[model samples]
Target: MDERSQFLADAAAQRKERELNRVQTETTLKLQALARGYLARKKFVSAVRSTTSEKFSAFVDLEKSEKVLLSNDEVLKWSRLFLRILRLPDDNEVLALLVPDTSYFHWTPSRVISDIISTIPQSLMYISGNRVTENSLFLASNEHKPLISGQALNALFSILFKSVKNDENLLPIFISHVLTCPAIVVHLNKANLDNFLNSELFDRCLTYLRSSPELVESIEPQKTINLLGNVIHLGYLDEETVKNRIVDWTWVIGLVMAQCTEFAVRPGEQSSHNHWHPIFGHYRLPIDPKLWKKLGGGSSSEPTHTAELEKDIPPTLAAIVCQLYMTALSTMTNMKNEIIAGICREDRTLRQLWSYLVRWGNQGRYVSSSSTAPSPLNAALSLMSCPQSLHAAPLMLFADAAAIVISILDEEELYERAVPFALEELVHIARFCNYFCFRAVWTGYVDDRSSDHGLFASIHQLCMVLHVRDSRRSFVNDPKFWLAPDVKSSILMGEFEKKTPRGVLLMRRMSHLVSLKERMLLFRKFVSADKNSNESSATLITGLDEAGIDQDGVFKEFLELTIKKVFDPALNLFHSTAAGVLYPSATSSVHEDHLALFQFVGRILAKAVYEGIVVDVQLAPVLLAAVRFFIQILLDFVVCN
Candidate 1:
């Protein structure tokens, strides 16, 4: 054959190989799903007659029943109830059915259903209770026990787990119930616990874990969190974990955090979100979630220690683990922060030491990714989540994150450094005064639950922080940043009392920066839309905040100065390039508070260029010149670009 022909054939062969590999993978995943359905405790088989269609084929099992329970018209679609059967059993001879509560991504489990049916040529039974609603099954029979023995069940669950790591909810209970063995709730040491990932050790732990299953509607959030924390702690977390688990970790960590978050909110807790329909018109996990903002009220009660964790684990490492959770974790930031602080005491400069956890200096973007991470956010409310131990360094970490942003803006690489983070995260965090020292003279207290804001609490924080941070403290000297309102009379301080002007400004800056920073988070929802476009956003706007500044004369004057000094032209210019990345809600952060937005930036620029560090006296003029120069270059580049 000619060389070109041979090359073409080889290419075709490679393509075929990849397709085959994908099909096989999908087949394996689907079988596991079917197996899980077959093993579910409540699953009942029905025999039906004359069922012949592509989705299902009638199988006659006359031994159990003479009549066919399923027929062609009665083909089954076991989607909803099947979710309860979380894992696939090891026995291949076990015929199965499945119904999954739809997930956002097909990759998780449901993605491969088609592959399984196409390859295995099996029945996709439509189930309603034990009856076959859609497909007629000719066979109907099941034993109380699976054919597999104890060892078989473990190996079966283990192999299925290797393919699917995150779906433990229904499986844990099933394993516990089916095995008639209580799950290993806790072990004595890390060695037996499998902290470091030695497969044999981990296998032992998993075997033990699979055995014990004392089920309860979440009773203790901390108690469950401690037991889980130990398993994660035993693993030697480093570059390898990151490299190997990027795709898997997204689900594993997501599931782990989700479970913890559930415990955090417990069933009836009044959540800080509007979506939570408080059962008795109250709350869930911890004292109505509606009151989450107030629950950890006094300053001293931060959730820092976990009884299950090895106390000897370096505080720095503990801090990194906790700080990664800085954005939100159900409990107020301080409660989380205190835990991190305890760990950070062991090592002060953990950020510098831990490069994997953070992005810095050059590999940064002007906008966060268009996609928002939901697991981390959802876990925020679930009491079952592993909450961050707010050790000391997060405060410092926030400072460092803020400093990096400030320095970059001065140097004109602000877009590069802050784009990836969407500055909104830092700004939202500023209200607490953990990262930046600045604050507005005005009180920055926003109502909690600001509308079931998913991960967007970070966004809400930005708008409110920037809205109030610029005025002199005397403006709101009625109290400070951390001050709790006293309906009856006067108030008192926690940790650091009597807030400062500088503190207020710094707080607001993050508020503003976070808004600009979060522009990139809206893209995921945009992409998630189906081609039919029924559920997508009506508009690209992240959010829109109607002007909430009802103050009369005083705030009006402030608005003018802000527009002239900050908001107009400059914000508008960046918005043109960035608006695509934001949803209306995110954009409304600025729209909500015009004066605060402008003044907050104006003050910071003024201070840095004039009062604070003087990177360049002609910073303003230099910026203008850079803009003009960029315009000229862009004009030329536009022709080609």
Candidate 2:
């Protein structure tokens, strides 16, 4: 209210306003200077681009077709522009593009390209492990050379091995990309890789991959596992280069390493390796008290992570090589479709793709097999890599391998065959279950388990995994059979069948998965008036109680059986019922095929239980095949006779 006080406050306000205005004018002046600098840089870039475009346009030598291919040259132009932005002086990326030509396999790079390359520090671009970039150029889009033509495409990828081996900076990038990039993967996998593999480029990768202080990581080590999966993606290599070098035994001994990738579960121990999933289930492995000390190991007091694992020598990678093939097989399948769909049929990489598949299946783990018999399933997978002429041999062999595993049970007896074979099946089944789990993933029952990063551990995924693992051949729910439950229950199936447990008391957990109506029908068998069907529940119970049983095997078998028999109540309603659809070239959705295939497999299992014969122990699809050229050849000979 006092005039003198108001006047003092107004003068202070005017001083503050003047200071703010003075600051704004200075900032505006600085911004104008910066803008001019940026515009000059932009103008210089435009002039350089115009000059490059004019240079390309002035080429009267281009054929009409060549002009069309190079006319847009968007990818190249942008690549060069980006190279300039990085403050590089010359057109090295373009030169890098020209080098992959088999025609120029002898030709040298442009002097400028060489200079640029030489100037680039290996420290910034090295591909090997234990490295990091000062600036992250690893997945930058500018360096991406999409495989588009014969020599261009070939050189693009062929040089990747070179970049990986010699360009220390590029190695980690390559591995990281292979483990992550969907597009580059689509392209590299597309090439028919036989010839390209072991080419000087690939040979280098093999040499390095095989080199010691190999790539294997400590089990779930503190370091991030983002790149560990790339191992399963590569297809060709000598043992020295691949299996012996990259696998870790602690992880290999079971499902831990198997879980390292995006796959469902470790294909049955791939044992020549290990199972990542907790296959032991409710059955704990009973450590033979004396044997532990005999092995010079744990008295149950030693830390589980003690260095003693070296004594076991770990599961060799060879046993699970087949499973690894399956892992790569899907990648190759994607490449074949996506890459070649845009390019030619006979390009170098596409041709090499053929070879990679053959090698992919057969390579990886003799080290794994020494400790256990080779998996027939693993052997069966080798056909994915074979040349067309040799396909039949592996088919026949895979069939034999599968049958051998199906017939045997005891690991001691299986040491030479059965256990390994079953483990191999487990691997494939694990992959299949993973496939199912992802498809059937209980989404928004939580926020899409698929995006959970840890969805692999979700109940829905684990359940589908266990379901697929325990069942021999499930196509969905159609008639998927549960033989006993595990081998223990499988053995008891005959005795169970003989007594028939009319009231559903014996295997209540499993039968409960079925409806009351279905259980009632099954129960009717026990109380049947026919003498053959009379209740022998007492005999079944007594047999089960006859102590001194193999405890681990019993529990494992029971758990597996419970998994197999427990189906979603709606499983039968989801899949098809038609017999023809079971083997359709391309059936409908996975949900549609689930039941019929499940049921058909269930029927085969029922027969196996009744007759005590191994149900078609082969991995090849030969049994249900409708046509046979070999049979025709045999018939022709018979007619001539």
Candidate 3:
């Protein structure tokens, strides 16, 4: 029985060994097939690389070598190789491959080529570290000139929208590159912009902006706003289209306001003081005697020559832009209060927008002789005067907006139409001037010291505007004109009557000036009495009883606040140990912050004197305090050393 069992076990072991051998044989066959296939693919890829390189090299160096004209099948093969190698292509290799002529073939298989081109932008979105994709797309547009056609632009826009949708951070770079591409601009210039605006791409962009409020405030939106400006300039969209698209108008206004707010205040380091730098001084006119003589001899009268130099000319691109903004403004019916708030906010975006509108309108005035310069101030006033609106709301809203506008105007331009408009419109002017006074005082205490000069200059300009050279024409000569009981009441009790402490001070000053109308009458009498006198006149007092009121008290308080808010912080910074160390070849330990304060205080004092806002006697204490502070800083530095 044992012998029989052993014989069965041997047979079973033999059968199992045979089964293992059969499985091993199948595995070896599969390995052999995979190796053979990989080798075949390697050889094919090598051949494709060598052949494409040779052809592209010949094309790029055609001047040195014969032009290699490939057949359609050969070109198609090259395109297929590019598609396959799209994972990673060498820079020199791809540039040589994507020459102007070779890029033309990319569009032959329209659907396939479009799919391939679309992938590039996606690849750009994903593999941000890769330069090949960006280079490939740029080369296609720049060197190959393939993106000029409507089909190509549409494809590019689709790709851009998709990529930006996926990663919103890429919106600015994508918009900047795509919208400003020379080919795209050229195409849009000649092509119908309305078609592009009406396309799916435009709709997608509108949706994107609507969805992303953060994007509306960023620098990215400027590109879109600029593109729209170009479209309007090119006359692609008519008035109706612009008006009907509330989304587009709101987006643009928000963008403009955002840009304005961002750049409202010039950086302290880049302030106008830098214009006096040695390197930059060459660009400025020298203060030579001859230049002064020439200027003195020039016309002292108003600028009689309008900015328009040519008559019968068509409206300019700037004029069209102005018209577009005006249209947008008209449609901003519900946004009027928001717009006023934006203007009055410290960001100064509204002020910057106002300046841009004026600058563009002025530029347009030069191009189209018949076109009137667009005035943001005028537009806001017109909105205020709109018959459909309640009078009180518009009046208060526009009063604030006008204050911001007036605060930023160039000193020379202050007396132009703005002052005249204020003079003629008594109800609005009273409110406007009241706000202006508040701004003047608030800015003096809160803004940079250099800016105080402008405030003083503006005040001086206002005084000049009110000066009665001709008594018959002077508004001040007529008590009913500016000093009406209703106007005085409105000025005193308006929305901003005592909103700020500084505002209260301003109102007090205004109240005193308005209450003493006899002083204005006396000044008018003195002015008319000595119209021919070349001698400097005496200070015109309102009256002895009123003069006893210490108006300088407000100015003194303002200077004290400036010392506390601006000077003390600077003094503390300057007295720090880090500020005591001198750089090589330095003469003193005084830092720029200290010097800036000195210059700032000097300018304020000088302007105060010039504007007759404060006398030297009143400024003496402020100057003494500044000098004593500087002396203390110097003593600290000396003792530390």
On lDDT, the candidate that comes out on top is 3
lDDT of 2 by residue, 1-641 (tens): 69999999999999999999999999999999999999999999679657755654544333542643322245457656876687434556756544653233222333323333333333224323223321222232113343244445444444344435445445435543433332233344334253334444433433433342234233222111223333334422333444443443212222223233322222233332322222111111332232123333200111113133224433234423333332222223323223223322223432233234335344543123354334423333322222121222222222222222323233243334423334444444434333323222211112232232222222233333234223433323434333222234332334346654321223332332333454455455544444356556564543443233444344445444543443212333222122312222223334665556656655654544443333222211222222221112121222223
TM-score-superior candidate, 1 or 3: 3
Better of 2 and 3 by TM-score: 3
Per-model TM-score versus the true fold: 0.24, 0.27, 0.34
Look at candidate 3 and tell me the lDDT of residue 66: 62
**What residue runs in model 1 are displaced by over 4 Å at the alpha carbon?**
1-227, 233-251, 263-324, 327-335, 346-641
After superposition, which runs of candidate 3 have C-alpha atoms over 4 Å from their true positions? 1-112, 119-124, 129-173, 176-195, 198-200, 216-241, 260-472, 475-481, 484-512, 515-641
Worst 10 residues of 3 by lDDT: 297-306
On TM-score, who's better, 1 or 2? 2
TM-score of structure candidate 1: 0.24
Runs off by more than 4 Å, candidate 2: 1-118, 121-164, 167-170, 178-234, 237-313, 316-641
Which residue pairs overlap in candidate 3's backbone? 261-349
TM-score of 3: 0.34
Q: Cα deviation of 526 in candidate 1 (Å)?
A: 45
